[model samples]
Target: MSDPRPVPQYGEYATPEEVAALRGTAAPGSPLLPQPSPSPAVVSLRGSTLRRLDRPVTIALIAFGVLNLVQFAGVLLDFEGFLEVATKGTSAEPIDFTDAARIGGVVLFVVSLALVLASAAIAVLMLRQGRIAFWVPLVGGALSVLAWGVVLVAIVLQTPGALPPAGA
Candidate 1:
């Protein structure tokens, strides 16, 4: 190793001035330093009505959310009875809409119920103002809106008289 020039050697006695400086009279190399303090940029959303739910409750809500909202679209779309001739002694043409609408309504209602639970979980997550709390709720709300849009499209696309695509 190269010798360090200006390096202090062992057995060197400390001066009274150096000792005082070390104690509290030390000069700072940089005078512009700021004292350490807690960060002031914190953000939070815990006050919303969604924080009351526990994990298991939210898990159940999520499951129902996916099931009801997701299936609601399929039911609204009338996937069944889309390609068939009128049966004898029955109404003209394929109009099997009873099942579709009922199922769709049930699914959507269930999802709406689950959304309440999801709201609770989201509220809980926000209590600490953790990074996740901010994004999770924002993203979830957007996704739920998108899912509703999809359901609307399904409803529009599959009116009673509408037919399914070929081979569907």
Candidate 2:
């Protein structure tokens, strides 16, 4: 027995009549083109993928910011003691923690903490907007370090006696 079903000769998409028409053969019936259906919605993977990656990164940023805040606060709270301990093992001579040095330490702590907080805030905003935000925290941490160096340098420049002589 032969199957009664009509097979598409050109491809599954082309009806037998359409294929026959393309081949210059007379179609048994008019091969009307099927109406095109609306295209399926395009699902963007970027937002969802970034959201998944953002959670862990945000958490890590929070932890890092908190840890830095605590350390910076501790150093600020015990400015002189922190300096003494920090300089103990170094070959450099004892540092004179002057009033200017104390002020610089406070400025450093405040600026660094502010940067951390600002970065965390910006990262959160970026994450909410579905943008990659990991770089913010890294840049913030670097800026904090830069602030620390700048403050320290400023203090040293203000009080040249704060450091030992170049030979010593």
Candidate 3:
């Protein structure tokens, strides 16, 4: 069976007979021009397919940034404490391990800073309704993982067993 359909032409308007033929409905008294449906930002956003998909990623990135800031502060403070105890005379203490930790701490600081900055960038993109914003959280998440690794490494290297004893 040949399915009868109305043909909508761009240059010319569609007549009632054409619409009737296309829709398989009754024809109107006059020709009906196809009007573009409104996809306003506000209305489209309510049920946007892309936004629905990105909602989880954006939330995770934002939360990750917040957590990073907290951890960043803690890392810096702990590094400072380690410095004070390390500067004392060469005892059986793990002050020597501080050097390695200092390096790890610096890495964590840079990674944390990057996470915060990346999150902001992504947020700006998202607010502008851009797809690039969706990738921002992933970058921050990666940085978070790196920062965690740095902390773990630093902790392992700073353990007392790895340090020189007193009067060394």
Better of 1 and 2 by TM-score: 2
lDDT of each: 0.51, 0.74, 0.66
lDDT of 2 by residue, 1-168 (tens): 665868657655976676776788765554554434444442334435556777798769867877978867878766656776787877534556677767877887788778888888988898788687888898888888788788778867776567567899
Residue range 48-117, candidate 1, lDDT tens digits: 2344443444455455555655565544344333323223355534554445444455555555545645
Ranking by TM-score: 2, 3, 1
**Stretches of candidate 1 exceeding 4 Å from the true structure:** 1-97, 129-135, 162-168
Instruction: Encode model 3's per-residue lDDT on 44-148: one tens digit a residue.
Output: 665676677676767666776777678667655466466556656755354345455666666677777777777877676775775536677777777678777
TM-score of every model?
0.35, 0.62, 0.47
**Winner by lDDT between candidate 3 and candidate 2:** 2
Regions of candidate 2 where Cα sits further than 4 Å from its true position: 1-51, 89-91, 162-168
> Model 3, residue 41: displacement in angstroms?
20
| Local distance difference test, candidate 2 | 0.74
Least accurate stretch of 10 residues (summed lDDT) in model 1?
79-88
Question: Highest TM-score: which candidate?
Answer: 2
